[model samples]
Target: MRKRNTLRQGFACPERSTMTVHDAVHARRTIRKFTREAVPEALVKAWIDGARLSPCSANQQPLKYKLLMGDAAAPLLPFLRWAVMIAPQLEPKPEELPPAFVVIAVDTAIRAAGAEIDVGIAAQTIALLAEEQGVASALLSLRSREVPVRDALHLPEQMMPALAIALGHSAMEAEAVPYEDTHKYRLDEDGKLLVPKRSLSEVLL
Candidate 1:
């Protein structure tokens, strides 16, 4: 495979390699803190490509992507709400913000009301592909207030932003631990984020 190009200055190319789907699934985590290094544009495009190939409900394929990098990405940070369970603390500091973002939009003209399933699948596909490429990603959704993403990006009337994926090199590590009383994830003594997962025995019917 041909190597992807990175921005000449601050961007660093993610390490490319073949990773099993299982490995990518387990290795992927919701990264909130990120280094200053920018994610390569080519890698972002590849991730969107991965989402493009994801399954769609009734094959409507209404999903659209808006790629943002560097200064273009700054406008989006204010609209994203991070881990509510561990907010304020888990929120990325100004210096630790993701250098790239992919806004997942839905073309209402294609399949307006029933594209939630397709959105979920595409988001997960993007996340998994980013993990396989040695990049960190956080899938974020807007909170109570409406985000003016459409206006910011000049999206068509039919296209509406559904989710945003923050991307960059990770500044922190997170891991899944055994589920206890609550499903909420927490920070360990060492500051690592500990996400809880129910055992297979518990999840399997």
Candidate 2:
């Protein structure tokens, strides 16, 4: 008999789908509700590899990732504000919280300023890779929550938490629809998230 893949045996490795880049882009959404199923730490780390290879400004590569899972991730939950547009309704319940997260931190010691572009690129890379692996993801900007996050992670003074990407198995479905008067997402009667997106024609010009 052939040897089995040990990584799959030890962790909840969801089979990678045959999702194209375009498909992943179209299917990707900000998932607020996630299943309690534990996300494999190794798998989440692998997504960081994708971000590692992302382009950085002047190759400074100031971005660093901090991985959190299960209990370690719980502390940061209270500080994180989810789905501000929908507030409490879209906030994940205790049972629906993401089991893992990749916090992107900026190493100010290296290149403090002008790292925003690199952060965006790296974040999107992680999100797309997670989506391809049948994992749900939500990219969260720390903003006012930065202090609590840094404190919770015990990050060094030189490292600042810029963004957080929550990862887990999705408990709900969300779809991007053509934009109407307002470009706000809403939940349908079935609890499915309806995200309004501008059409290519409207954006092309």
The model with the greatest TM-score is 2
TM-score of each: 0.89, 0.91
lDDT (Cα, 0-100) at 31 in candidate 1: 96
Q: Please give the CA lDDT of all the candidate structures.
A: 0.83, 0.84
Q: Candidate 1, 172: how far from true, in Å?
A: 0.5
TM-score of 2: 0.91
lDDT of the structure predicted as candidate 1? 0.83
10 residues in a row with least lDDT, candidate 1: 1-10
Candidate 1 lDDT over 102-127, as tens digits, reads 99889988986878889899999989
Q: Count the backbone clashes (under 3 Å) in each candidate.
A: 0, 0
lDDT of 2: 0.84
